[model samples]
Target: MVIYGVALLAFCMLVGIILGELLGRLIGIEANIGGIGIAMLLLIFLSNYLKKSFNLGEITERGIHFWSAIYIPIVVAMAAKQNVMGALDGGFIALLAGGIAVFLSFLLIPLLSKLGNK
Candidate 1:
């Protein structure tokens, strides 16, 4: 059932949050870094495995798909809530990092387009 899929997502989210916290602590960051990313990746892999190996029904698939669709909006909202001022206060390094990331993402466009054509 779709409820089962929700439970599965929640479980993955919990584990991802724990793991993210641990990783942050290990790296001396003291923040929950990459938790949602980890959870989404986990959900992708495990849901595929369950669908292929266990023949999960359409309802569960739809439920998982719904959550996946909802995931990005939530992430965007959370990211928007982040302390951009604090990052700027850290120094020019943060701005540099952001610029580099934007440049790299723009660079990826042509590469991804070529790959898609292949």
Candidate 2:
């Protein structure tokens, strides 16, 4: 059922949040570390495993797809909660490091694309 897919997503999200909290505590950080990433990975793996191991209906697939389609926006919204202005105010070093990281990431795009082509 489509609802089952949603239920699965909810389960993954809860587990991810718990794991992330645990990880953050373990590392002495007061944040949910990689919670969303973990949830997304869980969704992907579980969905794929279910698809292969059992026969999922079209409605269930559609439900998964629906959430997947909005996943980016959800992630963006979650990330937007971070204090970017505070980071910027921290120091020029933060700005410079961010700029360099962005530049390096941009520079890697071509190489990454070439690798993808192969």
Candidate 3:
């Protein structure tokens, strides 16, 4: 069952990559990887539903490990690029935005959880 689930996950990702490439070329939206993002979001919801409805085992931790492994090379390549130094010019802005996002999420999650419980 784990093997089957793994295969299915790989297939979904492959399809997402192919579709993303095709759509990016067609629309001239330079290098958009939105399909993979959409695929991941769908997978998250599907896995949650399956786990709650059918008692499938939680595989989120394993999935996170797998994705981290997959993204490491891409991250390394990006960091190696010539413009990497220039990219850090906006580091402070990026940090601020990220901090705000984290703050909002931290504030909202507990409130939302409490509201849901009520």
Candidate 4:
């Protein structure tokens, strides 16, 4: 049933949040670390596994695809705003680091593209 898809997503989210919390604590931080990203990855992996191995029906597939399409962007947008606020609060060094990271990522795109071609 389509409900299974929801259950799988909830399970992934739970695992991700718990892992993120543990990781944050391990690193001496008081926040969840990469929880949402972990959850998204889990959902993607698990959903594909289910589809391939168990023959998860059309209904379940559609449900998972629909919610993922709708939910992830909203969650990511919220997280991005929080990150920006936190970075701003952290000071100029945080901003400089973010800017450098962005610049490096942009520089990597062409190199990555070339790697894909070869």
Query: What is the number of backbone collisions in each predicted candidate, taken in the order shown?
Result: 0, 0, 0, 0
Question: Per-residue lDDT for 1-118 in model 3, tens only?
Answer: 4555676577667777777787898988777567887668666787778777886555644654576577878888877876756756768997799789999999998788889595
Model 4 residue 99 CA deviation (Å) reads 6.7
What TM-score does candidate 3 get on C-alpha atoms? 0.43
Error of 3 at 3 (Å): 0.9
Which lDDT tens digits does candidate 1 get at residues 1-118? Answer: 9987678879999989999999999999989999989988998899778877897777877776897799899999999999988988978898899889999999999998999596
Task: Give each model a TM-score.
Answer: 0.60, 0.65, 0.43, 0.62
- lDDT by candidate, in order shown: 0.87, 0.87, 0.72, 0.85
Q: 7-37 in candidate 2: lDDT tens per residue?
A: 7778999998999999999999999999879
TM-score leaderboard ranking: 2, 4, 1, 3
Q: Which stretches of candidate 4 lie over 4 Å from their true place?
A: 71-104, 115-117
Whichever of 3 and 4 has more TM-score, that candidate is: 4
Which has the better TM-score: candidate 1, or candidate 2?
Answer: 2
Candidate 2 similarity to native, TM-score? 0.65
lDDT minimum window of 10 residues, candidate 1: 55-64
Pairing residues by index, what is the TM-score of model 1? 0.60
List RMSD in Å for every model shown. Answer: 4.8, 4.1, 7.0, 4.3
Q: Write the per-residue lDDT of candidate 4 for residues 1-118, one digit (tens) a residue.
A: 8887777778899999999999999999999999989998988888677767888787877767788688778998888777566667988888899899999999999998999595
